[model samples]
Target: MTEQKTPPPPQIWPTLRAADARALIRFLVTAFGFEETVTYGDGDRVDHCQLSWPPGGGLMLGSVRDETDDAWALQPGTFGAYVVTDEPDKLAERARAAGAVIVKEPFDTDYGSRDFAARDPEGNLWAFGTYRGEPR
Candidate 1:
């Protein structure tokens, strides 16, 4: 048998700001199966958080702040990301059960990917699919 190598941890993190960071975090965890790895800040203001996708990548996020308060002024509800998954159908079902808005049902892409799109409670667009992206 051939040996397999473990992939390195993700270095590039997709980040977003949420108006209701705590609730958004909960929704992401419950609706999409993102693991809540770490969270900072007190009360409802999430200064920083890392939600790890079980499949080997993760994302960073924080509470929204005014432009004057934070240099990264990413607006809530304006973020979008595509997540790779092996089971888009089951994931979509789970998302729907958790009340995620289905923007697009599972479909086959021309390039041979099974994908589906949904909107998070914060209005961020999340596409889950079987595409692992082109080899680097």
Candidate 2:
């Protein structure tokens, strides 16, 4: 049998703030298939959380707090990100079935990539596509 290697942890982490962090996390997992790695906080307030995309990379999020209470004051519903996926159509279907709002239907791009866009419950725009970026 061949050996398998685990990919290294993501170096850059996209971050966001949510009015209802717990609910946002649930929606992300149920709709987009993000893996909830860890969460910290008390009650409904999420101080910090990490959700990992299966393909690679991940994102961090926390509950929205008053600007005076926290130094990083990211407003809810103001985050956007593009994620690479091999099956945008299938993912879009899953996301739709999970009550995600499909902002853009699955379509082919002129640059040779399948893509789709959706909005989570908190109104974060997420774009899923097959373009893995240009070669480094």
Candidate 3:
């Protein structure tokens, strides 16, 4: 009997809508250490942007809608995402120094993880921790 090939696991890429995408991109790189991979559109209107986390994974974002364009846009802080990192304290410190809003200081979780939460310039909540979910 031939063995069946298993399908690939689902990828989770967090997407956010920023009021000022141009500025938000800069903030994300400086504060959270996300490197810009690709950006679409121009000027103040950002159609899509892909950023690479320092460790792994990716984040996508776009600019807020204009007065007449009513597609789908999330208000800042309306969504939250967790990121796995090696140093939560250090990461939090870096973010704080870069002017990110530190919502929760780094702390040891009962689940055996050190984590911290912060709000981006556009008020997007982000959590960085030592906990990397199990891979399928």
Candidate 4:
């Protein structure tokens, strides 16, 4: 008998409707290093879309309507996402060039990591930091 292919791991996808989803997808890819997996929608409304890092889940973007109650879609400028990176300084520079507002300059943390944060056009926060502590 032939073996069936295993499905990929499930991911928590967040939906937003305050604005166009395509624009967000593009930003995530270029700024955050996420890859656009797939998108679903019509001429002007994006029903849902998936985005992630090359190897696995990172982020998902989608659209919403007045009838929907997804918490993620309700708040446009109040959401933030933190991600770890190996080069916080370089990522900060890239983010600045991509038009993201630099909310915090790169700084070393007591936790032994160089970290910095930025805000996108939609007000989503992106944190890039490097881990400097040895494994316990």
Candidate 5:
């Protein structure tokens, strides 16, 4: 009998565009506790940026391009993400201190998770929560 081999899981990373990529990078670091891994661009013009959250996870971003006709064209705030955190309240406090727009204060859900929602400087929605979803 032959043994079947399982394929590796796909790698998915959320990509976003920011009006002020430099400022956005700083905001993400100060507020969301993301550490910069790599950034490409000169001066304030960021062509691409990558950040790593402590322990695990990462995100990619870049400055909004002027090309409007391309399929990759996207506006600031077009993307939203839900980040898993061990401490939602602490994260919320840090985000608030860094001037993130708090759309919803930290609250407990009936499903037994603590969560909060906030908007980035460019208006992208971010939800931090303890919930990891259900396993199949």
Candidate 6:
């Protein structure tokens, strides 16, 4: 397989903080087809959770400790996730219905993609697009 980004530690972990981490995980799994790989927490309070996709890649989720630890903190329009999908429009719609804030409307790009962007609840931006490059 072609190497990309040093290959994750068997996973491409992106941190996510939500009011309901479980719900978010459920939504990701059920709606987006992610599988719960490893979850670490207590009493429904998740300190850290891992979710993996079938083909490859995984996302990391955790609880926000509202003290001095700002790692889990999210600011308005601050986070971003670039996801390549066969149907950008559909994914954007799903994201919108799932309460994601649509940042940029779908449009064609000179870089070779028809894409759109959305911001998740924790301020992370998710981008959907088909970036087809010229054959090497």
What is the number of backbone collisions in each predicted candidate, taken in the order shown? 0, 0, 0, 0, 0, 3
Indicate which candidate wins on lDDT: 2
What's the TM for model 4?
0.75
The lDDT per prediction is 0.93, 0.93, 0.85, 0.69, 0.87, 0.69
> Local error of candidate 5 at 85, Å?
0.3
Per-residue lDDT for 1-136 in model 1, tens only?
A: 5553544445678999999999999999999999999999999999999999997788999999979979899999999999989999999999999999999999999999999999999899999999876533
TM-score of each: 0.91, 0.91, 0.86, 0.75, 0.87, 0.67
Of 5 and 6, which scores higher on lDDT?
5
Q: Which ten residues in a row have the lowest lDDT in candidate 6?
A: 3-12
Q: What tens-digit string does per-residue lDDT give for candidate 6 at 50-82?
A: 888555666788665574667557533344676
lDDT by residue (tens digit), candidate 4, 1-136: 5554654443555444436667777777777677777788987677777776553446656664664655444655556766657778988888788787888999999888999998877777777777633432
Q: What is the lDDT of residue 25 in candidate 1?
A: 93
lDDT of 6: 0.69
Q: Tens digits of per-residue lDDT for model 3 on 1-136?
A: 5553643332678888888898999999998889999999977888999999866678898887863775665775687999888988988999999999998999999989999999987787899998776533
What's the residue-level lDDT of 73 in candidate 5? 80
Candidate 2 residue spans exceeding 4 A from truth:
1-10
For candidate 6, list the clashing residue pairs, or say none: 79-125, 80-125, 81-125
> Which one wins by TM-score: 4 or 5?
5
* Residue 106 accuracy (lDDT) in model 1: 100
Candidate 5 local distance difference test against the native: 0.87
Alpha-carbon runs more than 4 Å astray in model 3: 1-10, 67-71
> Over the full model, what C-alpha lDDT does candidate 1 score relative to the true structure?
0.93
Worst 10 residues of 4 by lDDT: 9-18
Which 10-residue window of candidate 2 scores lowest in summed lDDT?
1-10
